[model samples]
Target chain A: MRAWESNIRKVVPYVPGEQPKGDRLIKLNTNENPYPPAPGVAEALKHMDIDRFRKYPDPTASDLVHALAEYYGVGDDQVFVGVGSDDVIAMSFLTFFNSEKPVLFPDVSYSFYKVWADLFAIPYETPALDANFCIHPEDYYRENGGVIFPNPNAPTGLLLSLEAVEDMIRHNQDVVVIVDEAYIDFGGKSALELIKKYENLLVVQTFSKSRSMAGMRIGFAIGHPDLIKALNDVKYSYNSYTMNMPSLILGTETVKDDVYFKETVQKIIDTREWSKTRLTELGFTFPDSMSNFIFASHNRVSAKELFEALKKQQIYVRYFDQPRLSNYLRISIGTREEMEALFAFLEKYLAQ
Target chain B: MRAWESNIRKVVPYVPGEQPKGDRLIKLNTNENPYPPAPGVAEALKHMDIDRFRKYPDPTASDLVHALAEYYGVGDDQVFVGVGSDDVIAMSFLTFFNSEKPVLFPDVSYSFYKVWADLFAIPYETPALDANFCIHPEDYYRENGGVIFPNPNAPTGLLLSLEAVEDMIRHNQDVVVIVDEAYIDFGGKSALELIKKYENLLVVQTFSKSRSMAGMRIGFAIGHPDLIKALNDVKYSYNSYTMNMPSLILGTETVKDDVYFKETVQKIIDTREWSKTRLTELGFTFPDSMSNFIFASHNRVSAKELFEALKKQQIYVRYFDQPRLSNYLRISIGTREEMEALFAFLEKYLAQ
Candidate 1:
């Protein structure tokens, strides 16, 4: 590796879901919201005083942090914002994990956690998820530097209960336990309330999925004041103005408009339930997911073949090449119309 | 430190210039453009289709890169964009500098370079600038892993000639030499053209200074394809889609509008020249600047005293605590009206 840093060469980078171009496809990947953000968000962006953008944005993202704190019923000191949840996670790794002690995470959860651990040269332990793809709380009680997992874990879409999250945090009092609630708005209780009780709990969320602002790139974490301070220190040391002005303004407005969030999330949940029922009827076996996506596989059709077949029909879905979950396809929940179109394409492709 | 990474504890972060609040003051710090971005930038941002923000931004920022490539007269493959030029520099440290070989840069250049080097754990040697506060290219030709310096460099607005840059690159063929042209548009030659000849040359520029999009946070580098590929690999391993949607569109439009860029740079340069002459006539000693700011001090006034005096007059200027530079104040080139007000206040203060 030409004498590069040992960590840089050894890093296994995180691969985000494919974002293919062209408007001619029924795209059901990356778990992005099918609908646009709230009307208030667009209006906020439209009315942004571009003249003020010449000034550097507030390093604290003060207004957005205040808005999130009020919404989550936590004090402002409990919150921290970044470019996105990915940035928040990166900051967390730098803050908590070290070369000496290994951080712990679920084996089949968000892939980025492992990548970040490697990039930071932090030793890590990936405790296997049980056969049904559930995270056991007791496994995390062991000695480790920190713990992180997507609540409604990616790929599997299986969620750990808030009680389980509390158990892990309570037992692992000396280490930071981060709950990445990127998809919690779709389902699952947020561990935000646990911040008051557990100094080690850091709940991370993003505007990308349920808020439908992936292109905007804003995310935040809620934790005890000490934990938040550690992250802020790392962020300031790295990049001061991590969140841009437009994202900050739009993110603040998105949090303020609770009505839009509730309505949009309800619609996605409805569509997800309907899609799961239809897939079951078609003899597809998958986890009963809490997130805005489903993990499924058909008995006769291989996931790889089905993925290719759908691609030929101009319908896109995500298929993993990793072991344990290689046979399943992770399908994002789209709008009712897009889901109907996907079913129609599947019917034709299956018959062929 | 409770099992935290050793490197995390050792990081002494970079401090960005102050972003003062309230609109009552004549803000001249932070080297921000006194003017808003081009009219087209505001228009592009105002009419942004929020729905487009739901999908991920172009991971490679191809459209922005292409537009920048065209403006800089380089191939798209020769360009790399990041969250800011700081991000680009950070990525460069990861890609080009090896831990075994020490990196080299000016001791008085961008402070963030040292921070990046430290964060990456890359050993670096800060070659001292001459007593005149000028960067001699020959100094960087010494054996090192890589070298970088801001042209029209920060704190002191001195610049190096393109010939000197070419000489340095010619001599240091084994190391990557980056010319950070952050303020090049003010009145300095960009080394972008040399990328075709010197494969080791990397030219980094930002939309923050001339284009007035600091709030949007976009910066880019023009380099050989291999160097660009290395940056991309590091970026992908870090956080893909570093630039958000509004920045991509606005930055692309701003880069293409060369007329606006030229006019803005001319206005700032003219203001800087006018301010320098006025300061000199008032018995202020300062370097002849080639950038959008003036660095000067009066024999009668301590830099800190002058800073506080100006603050009392609702005018803000940057003052650093670093050795040799502490006696001077760095004042950003504001609009003609703002500079006149500053001059009026200084005249009254100096007379007293």
Candidate 2:
């Protein structure tokens, strides 16, 4: 029975990682920053005018967009904000990936990419990453409708060079090329500086990772004027108030306080390096991750066994049950104390 | 030259009401609640833990959904929430309006309806309202892919009876029928109670009006489990974190405080009655309004001239430059003091 459902909308929804309740767990499933947001976030939330809820927020989110433009040294028209990177990327797909040729992406990129393609009825193909889980520049040189891939790609956390990104943009000059930089602040360089040269390039980023505001749900895109116009066109038609009051006000503060942002991101990178050494001692191997999470597989014990064992002790880490990632776990870097607890538990289990 | 644009996404975007800054105006253009949200809203903002922002919000919005479900006397799965009514309605078009047959709606209704149809490439037809600016049940008796219209329909605050709504559903049981009740709390009856008897009925309401949380951006749909399931499937496929922390927490508190909600709604309704009497004495005529706004036309003055004159005095009311509604102004019921000022201005202009 159709039951009032559209034939076009019978989609298998993208499953977000578990957000467990009890505070007892050392959660490392989703790649969230361990530190709190900038000091201004608390001040902003505290000083928020609750009375203003009677009126609507500015539909265009001009203040935040201007702040982003200023911070990135770009024109005001270059910036577009949304609920999250998920929202930005989803809108980008709707606006750009509509030609007859199939858009090309990595087979093992963020799972939501394929979901958006299927939902929008856009044809797509996934060129698999190499054996080391690295994106090959040559793979994206072919003709396509559009191209999108996460920089410092998720789970594996491998960063392709800025030079390689330039090659992909230059080759796909006829199509829109999106550089999803959701995890850029932790280590990898940003593609924002290249937006001036590549009119077809769109760089997408989120406050959920480095700025520690995943609960706030703020994300943005930096691109050329014409491409951004197309995005704004579709977004306005879809929903005018995509960015709410809290996001618009608080997100501006996040961009304004760049000193605190640098400190938080540097601290996370420090913790990640320390965890790398600890995991090696425990007989787990992973790539030199540039993002907030590390994708590792145990050399001795199966990843499934380790994932289950960690959950038993209330130390949660993500385990993909698919073919390629079935043997690995994507573990978000936490505070030093939380990482210690994870190592202590693994030490016991490995000894057994 | 299309300039790297998608042929499918060349949309003429919907233009929302102007949100003017620098508070020199008495704004009644959009049907936003004139009062602040519940008292608990301010306290909630003050006490929100900033540290929790590092983590993502609950994707399902369980607490808020549960509160709405409990309030409406429906199962949890029977409720669906989104960023705003615009978001909910847009998703409904994408999720439910599938068949090749054109969906039917009011020829003079909320302008966003036609915009959504154009954006999604869904075929739609606007059946003409009767000369009295009231919906005729017989107009919707024919076949359609789906149907949607606001209760106490916008720009003309006249309502069709519950029986009329049921008639549309009864006639179109094969498709979904949406009764958008954005201003129902002001005077009109809710169709939420009819959900139990009619699986095809989806009642959409918003916190932006009676609840006074437009800045918070919360709206919901009440329907049978299957219809609600269809909404969720598309929502999850689009963006998981549509509702953020502030919206979820504040919206939940709004539902819990029934006393405040009743008081605010009653206050608005009382003001609406008072405004009706004053306008009658001034030679202005209108229908018996069942919503917060009054659709009025003066016997002597041109709507265009009045609209321009009000703008000069920093008093704003909605004026559509379209057929049938071109002669009328949609004035939202403001506080007694604000309404008194509007009356003073009009009285002076008429004496001239």
> What DockQ results do all the predictions give, each relative to the true complex?
0.51, 0.74
CA lDDT scores, all candidates in order: 0.84, 0.90
Model 2: residue B277 alpha-carbon error in angstroms: 0.7
Which pairs clash inside model 1?
A98-B5
**In model 1, which runs have C-alpha deviations exceeding 4 angstroms?**
A1-16, B1-10
Q: What is candidate 1's CAPRI-style docking category based on DockQ?
A: medium
* Candidate 1 residue-wise lDDT, A1-352, digit = tens: 3222222343444555677888888889788899998999888887899999887788788999999999988889989998778888887887776536688889998888777776667799999999988889988888887778888888888888888888888887777788999999988998988888877788999998999999998889998887787777767767788888998899999998889889999999999999998898776889889999999999888999999988888889998888898899999999999999988877776777
| Candidate 1 structure quality by residue, lDDT tens digits, B1-352 | 5432232345665666777788778999888999999989888887789888888887888899999888778889999998878778777777777646778888998888877777768898988888889888778777777777888788789988989888878887777888899999899988887888887788999888888988888889998887787777767767886889988898888887789888988999999988988999888988778888888988888998999999887799999887988999999999999999999988988898
Worst 10 contiguous positions by lDDT, candidate 1 chain A? A1-10
Q: Runs in model 2 with CA error above 4 Å?
A: A2-8, B6-8
